[model samples]
Target chain A: MNKFGIVMLYSILLFSNQIFGQFNALEKGVFSGSFESISQWYQDDNKIIVSVPQDKWATNNYLSLHYTFGKFYAGLQYEAYMPPLLGYSRKFDGSGVAHKFFSYRGDFMEITVGDFYEQFGSGLIFRAYENRQLGIDNALNGVNIRLKPSDFFSLKLVYGKQRKYFEESNGILRGLDGDLDIIKLFKIQKNIGLQIGASLLSHYELYTGADPLFPPTVNSYSGRLDFNSTRLTLSSEYVFKESDPLDLNYFWYKTGNALLLNAAYASNGLAMNLSLRRLENMDSRSERTATDTELMINFLPANTKQHKYSLANIYPYSAQVMGEIGGQYSVFYKIPTGSLLGGKYGTKLNFNYSVYYGLDTTFLGGTQGFESKYFAYGEELYYQDINFELDKKWSKAFKTVLGYMNQRYNKAQVDGGDYPIVNSDIVFFDFLVKFPKNRSIRTEIQHLSTKDDLKSWVAALIELNINPSWTIYAADMYNYGNAGEKVHYYNVGTSFVKNVHRIEISYSRQRESLMCVGGVCRQVPAFKGLTLNISSSF
Target chain B: MKKVRIILLVVSVLIALGNQSEAQTVLPNVMVESITGQEVSAMNFFNDGKPMIISFWATWCKPCILELDAISDEYDEWREETGVILLAVSIDDERSLASVKTLSAGRDWPFTIYLDKNQDLKRALNVVNVPHTFLLNGKGEIVWQHNSYVPGAEQELYEEILKLTENK
Candidate 1:
């Protein structure tokens, strides 16, 4: 149906809540939904060399509605991208109903038909999900069934075609996952937990190529184990994929495998966590020709800390889906409130270290691809980061946060460039002061020094917040030591939020950068613009 | 042209149907993981007969951490007064899921935390952003909710809780 028809149908269903409400028997049914829109007006600036498209004004809008009555539930999402934002994919150029689903939940089982998202253990082998900010919604359009025959055992079955932009991919996917909780099944009296799960997934696509050696069907299997206690947790997952030729791997018919291990220990005031991962030819996609965040059947998130500061994000790392080896270790501690260093409110500290490297392999230059030892480390370093932060609250109205980070980024491997490795150091200080009558101000200063890439930089921000409703902020980032034209990226914005609604307006000079969320990265083009964001839930 | 006419007709019919339907108050029934990796229904968060707070947060969200830290200071008192329970739901995907326990433990937060690993519960609840909190009454109805957090906003939340208790 067209956009208008879909809107009409949505409005009808929305108002039907009241129609059903009038009937005493159906009055208990409920309706809930949310709406979000982001619009931007682009302006050209010669200094930054921005490329403004024909449509200077762009917006992305989404409206989702859900209804539930006892064991039955249904929902649909409508999305509109008026020519789409500059950085967004070109495929998302129109508006339509992107998702619709219906489901029923019974005592022992639940079944859903239509669009749905699901994930296997740790999402190493199969994951169908969405991230609006990243412009990714790979929900499957088929049947999803969850069967819980017993309290300790559950099984899930899925069969569908993955969503690719506004349409479904040509490939058909089928998956089954079963999980068993030994502790619960045996009714163990100890204060511990143990679970084991296994998954099997297969993808089928027609092969029209002349090469008969290409396999039209690819299958993968994964197994996982999880153990947890009051103060310690351990989990691991291993996946193996059959030899399948695809575009991402240059049509190589090499098998793929991945192994991930995680361990964590936490007590009253101290905690530590460590994670390790290895990937070998693990780029598993639904479509053979899919590229750049399209029709993916698995997830491999980078095992690195996600820094919150803008300066710290300049060198963010993206997980290498093909082959990589890395791990991260972190520790968090809180000083006692009465200690000398803790003063009155106790001090919080965090330390983290992470590193990644290319796989040690010997290229065979053929379909068989390469060979590598299981425990060998590659000679090329992809990325390394070490960071520390301290948070302290001195009094009722004063607080401060200090942090430092050292990073080594390999532009050649991570971003697909041949530039030299960039080494940088960053330090930041943030202070907040609260005034009477629900008023507060926060300020931050950050400096990043580097010998490569764009050289040294500095940034500052100040924000004023007025009680439960309004906030205003202004920030600037300047490349002070640039060998070329020294540029300053500045932004000013304000936001007003009420019960369930929020509206924000901002004007900024956005530099070309990679915006990432949970290791998924997207490149945003440089442009000066005025932007408006509105969101509400009901 | 015909589509516009049909849309108008539907709009009028919707107006006639009215917009007075009650909003959803009870939490959706979705499976989420406990801190110990056990799948628990989101509906099980309902306390027998006490107020409960459901706060959505992430480890990387600074505002969410600030809000939780602010509440942690006086959580014991709030519990003693209104018999309230707080459930912090971390919408951290697999990338940062391993840190939720360590961070919560390190900060000494006195509240039950759950992991919405794949965001099933997050999507069902229509939560578009972090630091979103819902206040439920003794009967498990969402009495009040707010999005975003500013310093001192916890006082306003406490006032809402006080009102709920006073009404009781």
Candidate 2:
């Protein structure tokens, strides 16, 4: 569908809601519509793996419309692929064709049927979602309901089959979840509140594999509790499941569980939070018969910081779901204004640290020394990071901030076994300065070292802002450590803004790797190229 | 083992140190870039502008982009009619910026656009969803805010913008 058609469709959806008596004609009409197109260039040594030509570029277009009436909002999205689209061929379960419809009604109570997305609890068991630009969608064609009778209570139920790309899985997926505030229900005292939740999911699918085994039905359950007081809070969740066999194999069926905990404390100008999680054999596939990265039934959203700066996120850590244990803690504070340490508008400070390790196998006793559900076999120190920052306002137009970060990366876990184990240490420093004339300058520098690979690297970035409408940025990441491939990765970019629209363009030499989010990752390839960006509202 | 323990200890210290702020606090370092590509620190964006209005948005966020587009159509007359400057920023990644240019140029939006590719501005603003808008006074202090967008939501934004810029 074209942009205009999408807008008209949205207009009609809003017109349907106009019966609510909350919008006028102009207010009820199509408010905004947009169409976006993406052209991706890719190349790799593995033709069988990539599936697309190395020398060609592929593209896709998306058009969407949004409409509203009172508290009701609805949206329609159309994504089209004109064959030879990069990644689309291998990614889609069907030929170059895909389309979806989504809508939501009411704030506290919503029902999404057809091809829709949903997340339950922490999404450990079921989460159907889409990142269209990434060509990732695990949307389910199911009946889902959400009900919140009170501020602290929520209940959700879902039953349907997952849409794997353009095709729907044969398995039937069903789930139930409920969340309630113990304190609110009992009308507890001040400075204290408690919340509890539970969830259950079941999947049924018939299977006839090469091994000639019937697909076993799968069952999963989870529970969580949270307690909050005047200055402290504690939250924890535990999940358990009965594992189905791989290809109806009698040897593969195994039970598993996962545990997560979080605690925090806060006071004037200072705050701290801590989290710990241990997962084992927790993979939940919707089809119940599928394996690996296909037919995933759930998503685990990360609670850590999703950095914006390039170097700081160069080795971003994706959450691991297979089996592992990790924890993260963070602190933030501010010096009082006018104090010795708080020169000018008080100095601000922040620090954070996180670490992940392979699980202890001895505790996980399984048959025939076949690892227990709790055991982790990978190398330790999958990924670790430490960061610090300080900010201050010196004068009316002269604010500044300085920050530094140190990170340790394990390529084995981050790269999904594609690359060898790499123990890397990276350090970064950044500065931001505001000019008196409403202009500003932001600069960053970084260095990375590794002994496993003969590569150490350095990077620098500077962005000049001309206030309210324009900015120019330049950056370079150099591989000073590579023995023979010493190359400088450079990027120069600029952006122009007017009202609700912004355009940003850049050129860069790149390296490719999988962009992982905890345990999930997508392969992002490297290339030498120029890129442009344009975005606006209305 | 010792190193792991030390690292854990440091993390504990950091969390302990972080406990001094208000219970529900915003990340101070998070800032959104304005249409002019200027980084508008989340904290400074409000509390300093002339009763500011901040909206959290994304290129893929249709309702949010639409709400702003509708407001921009009358933004000039609203500015001449009222002096409020509506700032709109895109949460689109660097790769999608080109489309924003062609898309916006075709529509000729009346507002300014900033890019928050990394969502720093979003985290600092304590926004979990797009189409979220915050209203602040000239001192940059936030006063009013709303989440999601309805068809006529711009009418409400205009009313608030007019009130903030009124007689300033």
Question: For this target, which candidate reaches the highest TM-score against the unseen true structure?
Answer: 1
lDDT of 1 by residue, A1-538 (tens): 5757766765566556555565424457777777788989999998899878887998887777777778788888877787688788989987777999999987679899999999999998999999888898999999999999998999999999999888999999999999999998999998899999999999999998898778899999999999999999999999999997888999999999999999999997899999999999888888899998888899887889999998999989999878899899999999989899988888999999999998899998889888777777799899999999999999989999999999999988888877999999999999999999889999999999999999999999999997779999999999999999899999999999998799999999988898999888988889999999988787
Q: Which ten residues in a row have the lowest lDDT in candidate 2 chain A?
A: A93-102
Off by over 4 Å in 1: A23-27, B1-21
Per-model CA lDDT versus the true structure: 0.89, 0.58
Please tell me the interface RMSD, in Å, for model 2. Answer: 23.1
Strongest candidate by DockQ:
1
DockQ numbers for every candidate?
Answer: 0.55, 0.03
Interface RMSD (C-alpha) of each candidate?
3.5, 23.1
What is each model's TM-score for chain A?
A: 0.98, 0.83
Q: Please state the error at residue A127 of candidate 1 in Å.
A: 0.9
